[model samples]
Target: AQSVTQLDSHVSVSEGTPVLLRCNYSSSYSPSLFWYVQHPNKGLQLLLKYTSAATLVKGINGFEAEFKKSETSFHLTKPSAHMSDAAEYFCVVSARAGGGNKLTFGTGTQLKVEL
Candidate 1:
Protein backbone atom coordinates (compact mmCIF):
# COMPACT_ATOMS: atom_id res chain seq x y z
CA ALA A 1 0.00 0.00 0.00
CA GLN A 2 1.05 3.60 -0.63
CA SER A 3 0.11 6.64 1.36
CA VAL A 4 1.10 10.30 1.73
CA THR A 5 0.75 12.85 4.47
CA GLN A 6 1.09 16.59 3.95
CA LEU A 7 2.84 18.30 6.81
CA ASP A 8 0.51 21.26 6.85
CA SER A 9 -3.05 21.91 5.90
CA HIS A 10 -2.28 25.52 5.02
CA VAL A 11 0.66 27.81 4.65
CA SER A 12 0.86 31.61 4.64
CA VAL A 13 3.50 33.41 2.67
CA SER A 14 4.42 36.98 1.80
CA GLU A 15 4.77 37.89 -1.80
CA GLY A 16 8.32 37.52 -3.18
CA THR A 17 9.38 35.28 -0.29
CA PRO A 18 10.40 31.70 -0.43
CA VAL A 19 7.91 28.85 -0.03
CA LEU A 20 8.29 25.48 1.58
CA LEU A 21 5.84 22.61 1.95
CA ARG A 22 6.65 19.36 3.65
CA CYS A 23 5.45 15.85 2.83
CA ASN A 24 6.05 12.26 3.82
CA TYR A 25 5.12 8.94 2.31
CA SER A 26 5.11 5.22 2.93
CA SER A 27 4.98 2.52 0.27
CA SER A 28 5.52 -1.18 0.09
CA TYR A 29 7.25 -0.91 -3.27
CA SER A 30 8.87 1.83 -5.33
CA PRO A 31 6.43 4.65 -5.96
CA SER A 32 6.00 7.65 -8.18
CA LEU A 33 6.02 11.05 -6.59
CA PHE A 34 4.23 14.13 -7.88
CA TRP A 35 3.34 17.66 -6.91
CA TYR A 36 0.25 19.28 -8.32
CA VAL A 37 -1.06 22.80 -7.96
CA GLN A 38 -4.58 24.09 -8.33
CA HIS A 39 -5.91 27.59 -8.62
CA PRO A 40 -9.24 28.45 -7.09
CA ASN A 41 -11.94 26.46 -8.86
CA LYS A 42 -9.46 25.59 -11.60
CA GLY A 43 -8.14 22.29 -12.84
CA LEU A 44 -4.97 20.86 -11.41
CA GLN A 45 -1.58 21.33 -13.06
CA LEU A 46 1.37 19.03 -12.64
CA LEU A 47 4.17 20.87 -11.00
CA LEU A 48 6.68 18.02 -11.22
CA LYS A 49 7.17 14.30 -10.94
CA TYR A 50 9.76 11.86 -9.67
CA THR A 51 9.55 8.70 -11.70
CA SER A 52 12.29 6.73 -9.99
CA ALA A 53 14.76 8.45 -12.28
CA ALA A 54 16.00 11.43 -10.33
CA THR A 55 16.20 12.12 -6.64
CA LEU A 56 16.02 15.85 -7.08
CA VAL A 57 13.34 16.91 -9.51
CA LYS A 58 12.54 20.32 -10.92
CA GLY A 59 9.20 21.56 -12.06
CA ILE A 60 7.37 24.59 -13.43
CA ASN A 61 7.31 28.01 -11.70
CA GLY A 62 10.75 27.53 -10.19
CA PHE A 63 9.49 24.85 -7.86
CA GLU A 64 11.40 21.71 -6.97
CA ALA A 65 11.48 18.76 -4.60
CA GLU A 66 13.98 16.20 -3.39
CA PHE A 67 12.94 12.60 -2.94
CA LYS A 68 14.59 11.04 0.06
CA LYS A 69 14.25 7.34 0.48
CA SER A 70 15.80 7.15 3.91
CA GLU A 71 13.54 9.68 5.51
CA THR A 72 10.59 8.90 3.25
CA SER A 73 10.22 12.56 2.48
CA PHE A 74 9.59 14.64 -0.61
CA HIS A 75 9.35 18.27 0.35
CA LEU A 76 8.49 21.03 -2.11
CA THR A 77 10.45 24.26 -2.22
CA LYS A 78 10.76 27.47 -4.19
CA PRO A 79 13.22 30.32 -3.93
CA SER A 80 10.55 32.97 -4.14
CA ALA A 81 6.81 33.19 -3.96
CA HIS A 82 4.37 35.19 -6.07
CA MET A 83 0.83 36.34 -5.60
CA SER A 84 -0.05 34.00 -8.41
CA ASP A 85 1.46 31.19 -6.40
CA ALA A 86 -1.22 31.55 -3.81
CA ALA A 87 -3.23 28.41 -4.33
CA GLU A 88 -3.76 24.87 -3.12
CA TYR A 89 -0.95 22.36 -3.37
CA PHE A 90 -1.19 18.60 -3.23
CA CYS A 91 1.40 15.91 -2.67
CA VAL A 92 0.53 12.84 -4.66
CA VAL A 93 1.63 9.23 -4.66
CA SER A 94 1.10 6.43 -7.16
CA ALA A 95 2.34 3.03 -8.05
CA ARG A 96 4.95 3.24 -10.78
CA ALA A 97 3.76 0.20 -12.73
CA GLY A 98 0.04 0.11 -12.31
CA GLY A 99 -2.69 -0.39 -14.90
CA GLY A 100 -4.70 2.57 -13.70
CA ASN A 101 -2.76 5.45 -12.32
CA LYS A 102 -4.92 5.97 -9.32
CA LEU A 103 -3.07 8.83 -7.71
CA THR A 104 -3.56 9.22 -4.00
CA PHE A 105 -3.92 12.91 -3.28
CA GLY A 106 -2.97 14.69 -0.12
CA THR A 107 -5.69 16.50 1.72
CA GLY A 108 -4.28 19.81 0.35
CA THR A 109 -2.26 22.75 1.53
CA GLN A 110 -3.75 26.15 0.96
CA LEU A 111 -1.09 28.78 0.42
CA LYS A 112 -2.10 32.27 1.43
CA VAL A 113 -0.38 35.27 -0.05
CA GLU A 114 0.21 38.50 1.82
CA LEU A 115 1.57 41.69 0.41
Candidate 2:
Protein backbone atom coordinates (compact mmCIF):
# COMPACT_ATOMS: atom_id res chain seq x y z
CA ALA A 1 0.00 0.00 0.00
CA GLN A 2 2.17 2.77 -1.31
CA SER A 3 0.59 5.58 -3.24
CA VAL A 4 0.59 9.36 -3.45
CA THR A 5 -2.11 11.69 -4.63
CA GLN A 6 -1.77 15.37 -5.30
CA LEU A 7 -4.96 17.06 -4.27
CA ASP A 8 -4.73 19.84 -6.85
CA SER A 9 -4.18 19.60 -10.57
CA HIS A 10 -2.93 23.15 -10.67
CA VAL A 11 -1.90 25.85 -8.25
CA SER A 12 -1.40 29.47 -9.18
CA VAL A 13 0.31 32.16 -7.17
CA SER A 14 1.43 35.66 -7.84
CA GLU A 15 5.07 36.50 -7.73
CA GLY A 16 6.31 37.10 -4.20
CA THR A 17 3.25 35.30 -2.85
CA PRO A 18 2.93 32.23 -0.73
CA VAL A 19 2.61 28.77 -2.23
CA LEU A 20 0.96 25.62 -0.97
CA LEU A 21 0.70 22.22 -2.66
CA ARG A 22 -1.37 19.59 -0.96
CA CYS A 23 -0.31 15.93 -0.88
CA ASN A 24 -1.48 12.73 0.79
CA TYR A 25 -0.14 9.20 0.88
CA SER A 26 -0.77 5.75 2.24
CA SER A 27 1.82 3.21 3.38
CA SER A 28 1.65 0.04 5.38
CA TYR A 29 4.69 1.06 7.43
CA SER A 30 6.92 4.00 8.03
CA PRO A 31 7.52 5.57 4.67
CA SER A 32 10.02 8.00 3.28
CA LEU A 33 8.39 10.93 1.54
CA PHE A 34 9.84 13.54 -0.75
CA TRP A 35 8.91 16.60 -2.81
CA TYR A 36 10.31 16.98 -6.30
CA VAL A 37 10.26 19.81 -8.77
CA GLN A 38 10.76 19.65 -12.52
CA HIS A 39 11.34 22.66 -14.64
CA PRO A 40 10.50 23.01 -18.31
CA ASN A 41 13.90 21.84 -19.52
CA LYS A 42 15.47 20.37 -16.42
CA GLY A 43 15.34 17.05 -14.67
CA LEU A 44 13.50 16.38 -11.44
CA GLN A 45 15.15 17.89 -8.39
CA LEU A 46 14.68 16.91 -4.83
CA LEU A 47 13.05 19.62 -2.77
CA LEU A 48 12.83 17.91 0.60
CA LYS A 49 12.47 14.58 2.31
CA TYR A 50 11.16 13.03 5.51
CA THR A 51 12.91 10.01 7.00
CA SER A 52 11.53 9.65 10.51
CA ALA A 53 13.85 12.29 11.87
CA ALA A 54 12.49 15.78 12.16
CA THR A 55 8.81 16.34 11.78
CA LEU A 56 9.56 19.63 10.06
CA VAL A 57 11.98 18.98 7.21
CA LYS A 58 13.56 21.83 5.32
CA GLY A 59 14.98 21.79 1.82
CA ILE A 60 16.38 23.97 -0.89
CA ASN A 61 14.82 27.13 -2.32
CA GLY A 62 12.78 28.18 0.67
CA PHE A 63 10.75 24.99 0.60
CA GLU A 64 9.75 22.84 3.54
CA ALA A 65 7.43 20.00 4.44
CA GLU A 66 6.10 18.57 7.65
CA PHE A 67 5.59 14.86 7.97
CA LYS A 68 2.31 14.45 9.75
CA LYS A 69 1.95 10.82 10.57
CA SER A 70 -1.30 11.36 12.38
CA GLU A 71 -2.81 12.92 9.29
CA THR A 72 -0.99 10.83 6.68
CA SER A 73 -0.03 13.99 4.86
CA PHE A 74 3.12 15.71 3.67
CA HIS A 75 2.29 19.13 2.36
CA LEU A 76 4.79 21.39 0.62
CA THR A 77 4.93 25.09 1.48
CA LYS A 78 7.01 28.11 0.75
CA PRO A 79 6.97 31.52 2.31
CA SER A 80 6.97 33.18 -1.07
CA ALA A 81 6.84 32.09 -4.66
CA HIS A 82 9.40 33.17 -7.19
CA MET A 83 9.33 33.24 -10.94
CA SER A 84 11.82 30.39 -11.02
CA ASP A 85 9.46 28.34 -8.88
CA ALA A 86 6.98 28.03 -11.69
CA ALA A 87 7.07 24.40 -12.64
CA GLU A 88 5.59 20.98 -11.95
CA TYR A 89 5.68 19.63 -8.42
CA PHE A 90 5.35 16.03 -7.36
CA CYS A 91 5.00 14.22 -4.08
CA VAL A 92 6.75 10.89 -3.86
CA VAL A 93 6.69 7.96 -1.50
CA SER A 94 9.65 5.58 -1.18
CA ALA A 95 9.72 2.14 0.30
CA ARG A 96 13.01 0.34 0.80
CA ALA A 97 13.16 -3.41 0.56
CA GLY A 98 15.44 -6.11 -0.79
CA GLY A 99 18.30 -3.66 -0.95
CA GLY A 100 16.37 -1.39 -3.28
CA ASN A 101 13.94 1.46 -3.08
CA LYS A 102 10.44 1.44 -4.48
CA LEU A 103 9.12 4.85 -5.41
CA THR A 104 5.61 6.03 -6.14
CA PHE A 105 5.10 9.42 -7.72
CA GLY A 106 2.12 11.72 -7.64
CA THR A 107 0.42 12.85 -10.81
CA GLY A 108 1.84 16.37 -10.39
CA THR A 109 0.70 19.88 -9.60
CA GLN A 110 1.34 22.53 -12.17
CA LEU A 111 2.36 25.76 -10.49
CA LYS A 112 1.80 28.83 -12.57
CA VAL A 113 3.27 31.94 -11.10
CA GLU A 114 1.55 35.09 -12.28
CA LEU A 115 3.47 38.26 -12.64
Q: Count of backbone clashes for each model?
A: 0, 0
Cα lDDT tens digits for candidate 1, 3-87 = 9999999999898899999999988888899999999899999999998998999999999999999999999999999988999
Candidate 1 TM-score versus the reference: 0.95
Clashing pairs in 1: none
How well is each residue in 21-109 modelled by candidate 2, as lDDT tens digits? 99999999899999999998889999999999999999999999999988999999999999999999999999987899989999999
Worst lDDT 10-window in candidate 1: 95-104
Please name the candidate that would achieve the greatest lDDT relative to the true structure.
Answer: 2
